[model samples]
Target: MKPPIAPYAFIAPALLLLLAFGVLPVVVALLVSVTDLDLAGLADWANVGFVGLENYRELLADHGFWQALANTGIYAVFGVPAVVVASLAVALLLNRSENRFFRALRAFYFVPAVTAIVAVSLVWGYLYNTRFGLLNHLLSLVGLPPAQWLGDSVLVKFSVALVAVWRGTGLNIIIFLAALKGIPREYLEAAALDGASELRKITSIVLPLLRFAILFVTVTTVIAWLQLFDEPYVLTKGGPLGRSTSISLFLYQEGFAAGRFGYAGAGTLVLFLVIAGATLVQMRARRFDADH
Candidate 1:
């Protein structure tokens, strides 16, 4: 039997693009990670000397790196569940109606996902402003003290993660809505005949049927939160004593700002491993639940 040439030809362009953009960069970064690559090395390849595991060792010892890792963890922990639950909830609400107004509301919910992060940050910046922002102004009207949303160290992580959660929920809501639509209407109709309440039908039948969708959304949301960067970068710049600095932002600062390409490459590799490991764990857990 011969392999199908047509199938390979069909996928070849996509495969080539992935190799060039995705796989090639990681390979180059891995190679660069073992060398003392910096600004000087960029100008002259001869300046890049082999320094096996040196950057990794330094990264392991660096307090800033550890703090960034912790901050990234915090962001993921806060954002992932919030995004998943909010997206799922919104999707369920949207799924309830096929009305034109509900359809319009679906698009409205998705606007944040398609909007540019820079623009979203600018709008959120005004909302977080202490002196004249709407949020603080509203607080004053309610006889509550105004909060320093982005300036307070403890509040900054949640503040940054909240923006990301808001932006993130939009796409996941669409994903969940699609999944919700795929569910057979007959199942719910039958459940209603059996005297099942809406909540009961959702808890018993709908939820189990939607397990695969939930897992998909959860895994992707987790990966996205793990790579948290944009919201914090635009809003906080990882300020308030680096409280909002994610590992990605930390790597950006190291690689671009400080001109430590090799060091940042090591961090990048570690982040890749973390994301892969987390994904694998989630997959395995889902499989285990499916089997038993």
Candidate 2:
């Protein structure tokens, strides 16, 4: 009796929390996705009605949905690679030096990751301002035109991606550094004995060992960028004709601003599906890469 009761007592709190928070919300959202839960519904629960997949069908026909999806894809395609490369490079550079200054730099780089998103977004917004911004000021010093980093269609996504990359690189750097530390010194020594150059040793030894870290970072980055909201929301409100509007922002506006809760729920479900599918593909690709 003590053994059985003790096991249940120990796991009961965790199970309760998981059911109350995780399982409950997912079930509620799934139900909401199939119904017409709107501002009216919020005011009076009786106002809600089952709409089935109407919201999803509406999403299929919505031009804004496709546009947001395309924008997110573009961001992930470019930003993920940039982040992976930058993180790996920085980790490699830092791995060579265990000095106190370099240790401090690691902490400094990771500061953005732990910082509040809204605070970071506000700072980046000021930096991206059209006039009297630090970025424009630097451009002036170089005799370059003061480009609208967040206002222009072509630059808005890139600017948002830059902020995300800045925030994310630190995390990936830590991950890559750990991966780097695990590499056997004998591998490097053997490569050196075989007359391998620095680049060759990295390509042949370091990268192969870091593949798991790379895959993990890339997958996580893709998922995060797909649901991007805060940076663009604070900076431009998905503005300049919605060029910076991501799926997350679209869903946010649909639910909160437009009171289209059902529509937003459908969008949320779609985004989840997309993330799930992408993760599966990435896992498969990584396994294939490892095999060969």
RMSD of each: 1.0, 2.6
Best by lDDT: 1
Instruction: List lDDT for all candidates, in order.
Output: 0.93, 0.89
Q: Number of clashes in every candidate structure?
A: 0, 0
What is the C-alpha local distance difference test score of candidate 2? 0.89
Query: Local error of candidate 1 at 38, Å?
Result: 0.6
**For residue 212, what is the lDDT in candidate 1?**
96
In model 1, which regions exceed 4 Å deviation?
none
1-292 in candidate 2: lDDT tens per residue? 4456878889999999999996787677788999999998999998789999999999999999998888889888888889889999999998988999999998988898899998998788788887988999999999999999987898988998899889889998999999999999999999999999999999989988888888888998888888888777887788788888988998999999999999999998898889989999999998898788
Worst window of 10 by summed lDDT in candidate 2: 1-10
Model 1 residue 227 lDDT? 91
What TM-score should be assigned to candidate 1?
Answer: 0.98
Q: For residue 49, give model 2's deviation from the true position in Å.
A: 0.8
Instruction: In angstroms, give how far residue 126 of model 2 lies from its true place.
Output: 2.6
